[model samples]
Target: MTSLSVLNSALLVLSVALVLLHVSATRAKPNKARTLFAIFCGSIAFLMCKQLSAASIGPYQFLIGIGASATCNAYWLFSRVFFRRRDAIKPQHLYVAVAIALLVAMNQIYMFLKGMAVFTPAPDALVRYILVELTLLLSSCILVLTFWEGCRGFGKDTFEGKAQRILFLSVFVFALAGSKIAKGLLADNPQALEYIISAITLLVMVSTQILLMWRYTNHLDFLTTIPLRERLQPSAATDATKATDSRGELSPLARQIRDLIIGQAQYLQENLKVSDIARELDAPEYLISKAIRTELGAANFNQYVNTLRIAHAQTLLADPDHLKTSILAIGLDSGFASVGPFTRAFKTKTGLTPSEYRQNLQAK
Candidate 1:
């Protein structure tokens, strides 16, 4: 191998080894999701090293194909863990995996039998490359969606959310790497594409490994402090049940509540009330009232709303955008009934008022 190849191989090998060690060490843990994530990282590393070598391209192509397929397969498993899917990996999910694997196998066989370049494209390069990019891109999106879905209904506040966020972010960066691969195939820019893809893959690998180690070794579980008992109030359970069926399927209302809380976390500063949410949702006021009290463990209705609003305002106050927006406006928008409540809540939650939080964020 040339100097450049040797250097690249060394980097790839080191990265893979580090990630593999973490994955192997964590395999005995009870967290299946973490284990699967480790496996996913190992697979990605294998593909990265294979692609870097470009020796005959067949191994590279096969690894890439399996990696793409595995990325999607991992999503179902992730969702199952996130949602506590009782059925485990269902037959349909397996069927989908089998289908993707079959495609990868067929693509690899055709490339090998036809004496085609594994990494390089022929006249049909555009079509082939597009398929590759789409497969990986779609798989990354699926994983992200699973994480997003899991964030609802007391999901975002847990270790799962943090893990999901990190994993999804890594997957997104990796998708960028795959996109570079496709770009290289489509255009004549070989060296630029190779370097870009390699760098991105390296970044993704490092981030993913760190996350795996932190989650497994540190036993870090985000949002685990929130009590499950408080989250299971009857009214909330009814709402939850409404959101999920007797079969524990996700209800539309459940999804709506998750979207409302998680997506508009920033908007909580508007001093939102249960009645306001009910009006906004077009659901009955009693149901919303019951849901919050039961699901959230709020001693009083107003406190419940302020909790989210205050948290959001704290984030804004700590953001660079605080320079553009006033503390009072942020308070009001965060659903604070008045300046006093906002200030008190902000201080209590963050040990700083809105103004102070913003100052700190800017300083950082």
Candidate 2:
């Protein structure tokens, strides 16, 4: 291997290790979506390792080939369940996996009996490559469709459907890498193309590792479930005050409500129920509700709570430090249990999807 290839391969191995560690760590948690995400990471790690080592073709390749095929298929299945997509748990899906695994295992046994270590690259390789690519494309389409549907609802603002987007993007990169590998399998100049494909794939794998870590751990503290650092600095408050103060008329009660909501967010977590805030401030529930209504220009108590949640969620989303975090999980932890309401509030406030907002943050 050339120095560059060695370096790239080493990096790929490191990425695989990181992902595996993340999967192990998250395994104990009963979070279905997160656990599925961990499995997705593991599958990618296995695929990358196979590419790096160049699976011995034939029986070994056959086994590895089946694993590789199943890994990609599993990713789509996992995504459906993770994203709450329907028909994910149907009998047909389970049967398909079992049938594929059986066939692949049978092929491996047959080749081994023939005293072959690897199967020769036969006409089947072409058919398998096309099928795998088509499957990946189908998965991509499903992801895109889910994201689009999620966007149509207010839930897009919350971290709800963003997983689909991230998963799709990761899959897209993998598919592109697979395309290069497929080309190598079919055409001349396989060696150089293999290295280039490996390099690009290494980049994608590294990005996936970073995102998985960020989503599951507080490696970047700013991406923590609870807001730790102050966002919308105190100066932002002063600005809001400045605008209101210029009129030489500030409603003390309304100002108090605003300060309480914004201040509680800055320090304490999202435990501020309207009644709790009302009791702490020694105000009537109705009066406190009135103050929030008039001051924040929002309707009802739940809307007020969601406003605060969305505000905090935005702060996390906007933070350059949290670009890797899961927007949906962040939304949930931010106190918006559902993505629809979160996305609506987010779009209403920021006029962009969580992914778009993150992209904008990255652009900056």
Candidate 3:
């Protein structure tokens, strides 16, 4: 095999392993973000395998195009799941991905039936133009979403935040590099550039996997690059096996969680994330999330954290000594990022703006 094919084969092997590992690992479960990430990674593996066997299997350019489309859809879905809580990979998401793949396939299927061969340029081919434009459009959207997630998550100190930054970097590199590769293929110039792009892709993927493991291990504090399945997964002995009755009654775990947040006031930490709390309790992030949502009456992690902040602010406002404190100061002290978000959250919880709530407090 050529050196390029050898490289492709190596990457293909690694990507396949990643897919299998991600799928079988129970620890990553109950986390839709991780599942979508696996899908994203798996799509990369498919493309790599296709490239590694391109000589024998033919370019299968249309199938490759479908894989590209699937990657885009997976990235978009992962982005949504990463940033939003309680959200999931909706059926429509799968439908859209399937639809895109079918559309691309149909274009090629028609050409093949008409006696057109693969990798032969039909400069005026409407199918080719349409596919190229679609690729560019998806690249643009992915770039936008990556940047959006990056900016919003900048300065986050939690594990999930670190993962977000890693994701942003990977996607940014992918989009930047993928755009160039798209252009090269679309123009059919410098075929060697495709090989180079594939190499770059290999590096990016490997580095991302390294970073993910590094961050996760560091956050968990005993994990090396490879953690034991039990250490990572924690099995059903955790919250997954807990009965509804066990959760409903303020269980010891639930009470300890409550005291940690309410009594110790961990919510005041501005950079707190569910994963951070999970590490603190030595429990799965989802377990902590479930406890807070089911037993503690939180709609989600953010809502739970924000409610605590607002409640703390209310307590501070009601203190006679703190009436002299400005609402902004109270908001900041309450762990809100700024006055605007604080005011909005305050109103959301109390049905009155900060200033109005303070005035009513004064009147009382």
lDDT of all predictions, in order shown?
Answer: 0.53, 0.52, 0.59
Model with the higher lDDT, candidate 1 or 2: 1
- In candidate 1, what are the lDDT values of residues 1-364, reduced to their tens digit? 3357545754665476455648654553334456556555655555555555555554445535444345445545644543432234668766765665555555555455445443445666776676567556655655555555445433223233345465755575466557756695847755556566555556655565555455434432221233222232223333432322333322455334434443323234244556656655689977766655545445455655555566556555555534577667777655666788789876765566677767766777
Root-mean-square deviation per candidate: 12.5, 13.8, 11.7
Which window of ten consecutive residues has the lowest lDDT sum in model 1? Answer: 220-229
lDDT of 3 by residue, 10-128 (tens): 57555654654365345421244455566666666666665655556554543553453456566667655544322235687667656655655565554444334534556547766
lDDT of 2: 0.52
TM-score of each: 0.44, 0.43, 0.50
Off by over 4 Å in 1: 1-14, 56-69, 79-88, 116-167, 170-187, 213-364
Better of 1 and 3 by lDDT: 3
> How do the candidates rank by lDDT, highest first?
3, 1, 2
Ranking by TM-score: 3, 1, 2
Query: In candidate 2, what are the lDDT values of residues 62-106, reduced to their tens digit?
Result: 444334434444544544443332223568765654554454445
